[model samples]
Target: MTFIPIAIYWIIALWGLFSRRPVLVYLFFLSLPFGSFAVVPPALTGGLTFVPTPMTAMLMVGRTFLDPTILMRAISSALDVRRLGLLTGFIVTALVSTVFMPRIFANRVMVIPVRGDVSTAAPLFPTTQNISQMAYLLISFATVIMFSQILKNARMQQTVLLALTWASALTVATGMLDFASQYLPVAPLLDPFRTATYALLVDVELTTGKRVVGLMPEASSFGSLCLSLLCLLYFMRRAIDHDRVRAFYAPVLCALLIAFAWLSTSSATYLGLAAFFAMAALEWIMRFLDSRYNLLRKRYLKAEFAAAALAVVAVAFIMLLHPAILENVSMMVDRMVFQKTETSSFEERNMWTYVSLNALVETWGLGVGIGGTRASNSAVAAISNVGVIGGIFYFGFIIQSLLRSAPPDDKRGQVLIVALRYAFVPTFLVGLLIGTTSDFGAFGAFRYGMLTAIGVTGLYHSSRMRQRRIAVSPESA
Candidate 1:
């Protein structure tokens, strides 16, 4: 199933290499997971078996971890090369282990499992896992910027924007479908849609009914995506213009994503959404102040006003439909300020933050090596003891970059860039502060790539926009 699409990718990679396009190489590398697992697999897996079970999709998605296997297989078949480095590596490692640890082997040695919120004994391509994880971390922040740059130079910007808009729209739609199917009545003997829909809606809980992950990875991830989409839509509005009729879908998508997130009953995710909303709101307020205080020129003020108003109306509608924002905020207030523990999440985060802080004391300067984030038996211990300081440095680099790169343009642009910059910082803090409670953020390549893409892309676009503004500005006169 993986071979055919992989063949096409190899062809493209060769073509890209032949063309001497290093960026294409980078993009091709960035795209392997999404391409092999995300795009081409439907035809491959769908064709292999008449029935496309959820497990197949999961397996394909899971292949992101085992990309080394895919790479090796592709190399051996396509290049017909024998004894690739990995084979030599396996032999050398096995020899070293067998010779040095013969007694260890005689004891029927057991492999100590890596601690994490979740664990799977099944091996993924270990090498690919590491490579992809790093790639994602580096690439996520660049994607948006690159796309924006491409749009700036190319006539294809409209098509690209439409594609991205559509992808986000579909994600919103699928998530809503998942949410609605959850609440709607199920009839077993009815048609496939009715039966399948009913099955998706069944109530299930995790951690002894303490966690409800919902259709998304977790409720919080779903909420974050929804909230991020809303922000993205607002940000992109100036770039793409359309009739008022189609513009309505933007708000509708945000509301639907939030609604589904609420139904999932993910308190942490809701908290994340609230944080995002607050940041966005603060941006709006800043823009308003700038407009009032002569901080922004009269030229862009009207567009800013329209954006702020649209954002507010959309948020108001979302809040009206799902009042959980208040409920979640109240729960947080009661817990944090009032000094009461309402849920495990609250308790876990606090514990982890303490531990992480202590860990920072021990490893204060240089960071712990890679795999430092490997889970500990306890969340707090894992965070603080297992290289807490290093994590801080890692996150600090991100925070500092955000602070430094934010556009210093008109008040509106400054506020918008600053707000966007701070958006993910809090989420990262939550994962850190919340402790080792779970491996929510650092688990897979896809999400890591996503974060990197958002960060890099945002920074790149802001710089470009700033340059463009300067290039044409009257200030140069």
Candidate 2:
């Protein structure tokens, strides 16, 4: 009997992997248990109530109490570890790339040929990195692995893109339904829908009404995810330009997603959005400048110019329509610019920054493990937190990657690229500087995790650009 239930989960997981359908994958993820009751076996489902805070911990503990064979049978039978393994490989490669590739490229300074021209440049990111920075680099490497492997297989890429598209669509649908749920009476049949739908809208101030946070923990995170998805949509739109149906819907959906982000009033999210837009603009500007004035035109400058113009206009318009967003942003900038010593949060952050420096000197090159807290006379113990030297290292890596990745010749390009690439930098910097005064290493893994994901995307994009250029050269042609 137990084997039967285990078999079901395995079967579903396997189907999800092999089918390689993006829509199905999105459904699978979103449909997965968000509560302990849903996660519990159907036979035991009725008894569960509280949702676990650390989902992975719950899974591990659940498997421990459950029959080992049953757990193994389910996990091994359904899911594709090969995909996971490939993802791991990509991350490992990224790590190596981060640690050595930059230094090698710097040393070699070879004139690697581009389309119709010879080019030589140093790689993105340097060999020397701080511990916190290393952590983000490693995580970024992992995300790249996932993106590359998934995209490498045509079927998988299609599946992923489709899933991402539909997932984006579904999020929109869920948000709408959530808004509608606020006014209407709930039908028993629509009870589940109501719960799922309404859960997305959040109350920012209990009295001032709720803002839409969606399935994410907060409005800001939700907004950030939407912005990330918008980038994905932009990629999809580029790929599916010929498909009028998808092309039309993609832009509309992207607009809606942006609107949701705006409504959330997450200032940090704007930084990321701005960063991506700035990167897009830089790419466009470079191509345009090259075409108009280059000794030889190597890339499509016209397309870049058009794209950049569109992006700039779209961003400007979004801001123009939402004056409240500007107000919020101004207030935030003012807070940061004229920081006061009176605020306890600000004061504590200053203390932590100093503490991290002290800890760094005490540790002297070796870092405490990721999310480690020691009771002994370690620097972390003395500081009563994750320590600043580590924070500096982690934050430093993000900055380094951005600097290394920016397009040559444009200072604006360099700054924008850094801001986008190191999207988590400001937030983490805020968390370190003003938001949370404590050592956030243990508490704020998500911020680091996001940095990891973004870094991997940037690295993968860099590698792909090189691959595309290399593949199209003389011999391949």
Candidate 3:
């Protein structure tokens, strides 16, 4: 049964490799739902489950090196001295922290380790977990670089959007399967894919009801995955090249993703939803205020405004007729989000962050290494594990990536930049509360890489355009 997933993965890999164009992007996004499926057994990888995303990323990295132009373009995206310097320093510091710092501070600090019995904080020491996590971090970073190079072309950008739309649909399909599996017996079919080394909490239920985990290990993972897709599809819709996809398919997928995310009953996802809507509202407000924007057309504004007004009227009418319905929703929100802090799960997560942060202080901000400590917060996890110096370098690199200037004349590229930025915030916010590891997942790496790639390509094109204009100018003669 397990062979089914492995066979499909290899077939896709071979197809991607032989293809003339970069099909890896399509394969990467499409393979994300198989998160629970380890292509290689844990026993072979020393109890570390290797999933499809990372495996595809490895293929991408190989592709990046195989083509000289691709390698150069990837490097050129970070050619800026400050960006390059920060990235290098981050890599160096993180390597040192992973290899040496834990041994130096062995037994001196208590931390929630990447692996082992993490019910409580344990004494920090060098372990295979550190090496494994560092390896993951490096792979994620390399994936980012590889994506940046591949995504520079406008055609490739459209291809990615199409891939995302299909992937979003698949995500919805998986959630539906998960939801119906409770009543039906088809969940056994999904079992073949749930062969990860770690514990699988797929069937867990929250007070609200069944937590829809989809094909992931837990509700949180599934919910956050939905949230990420929701953000990308919703925010990036205007920039989608295909009219049908942008108008119909994208909207449907976005709606389904939101529904699945809510059904997951994950507090982290709820927070992310709130963050995403807030950003969306802000975008609408901006669009309403200014009509000359690059991506978001004013044509959609009337429908959106009309929808908002209709929704308001309907809500008011519903409240007047059946106030109990409103109360039920409020209670659900309170149960899923507002009262989350009182739960034991929240307490344990809070402690993970607290202890990991204290471990940072214990190591004098040199960090306990990449996998040395665990935290519920992504920021704290990154800073605590990498220490203040590495954090500075890492964050600087991130900021540099996110703040890349779009080409002034390139509307599609500018819209893409806006979409990526707005899409990133929800994921970032959700990760702050429930993220377990410092290493941003493959999806995150891809987004970051795309951001840099878009910006760099825009700059290069704009520069060339300017040079062409100058060459034709009479002043040059």
RMSD vs true structure, all candidates: 12.1, 15.4, 2.3
Ranking by lDDT: 3, 2, 1
lDDT of 2 by residue, 292-315 (tens): 343223233454467557877986
Strongest candidate by TM-score: 3
In candidate 3, list every pair of residues with a backbone clash: none
Backbone N/Cα/C clashes per model: 17, 14, 0
What tens-digit string does per-residue lDDT give for candidate 3 at 382-471? 999899999998888778777776666778877778778888899999989998887887877878777777775345557777898999
| Angstrom error at residue 243, model 2 | 1.8
Residue-level lDDT of model 1, residues 254-322, one tens digit each, is: 556555545445454555556666765565565556634433222244654687688789878988899
In lDDT terms, how accurate is model 2?
A: 0.40
Off by over 4 Å in 2: 1-14, 17-147, 177-202, 206-208, 290-359, 373-477
Residue 15: error of model 2 in Å? 3.1
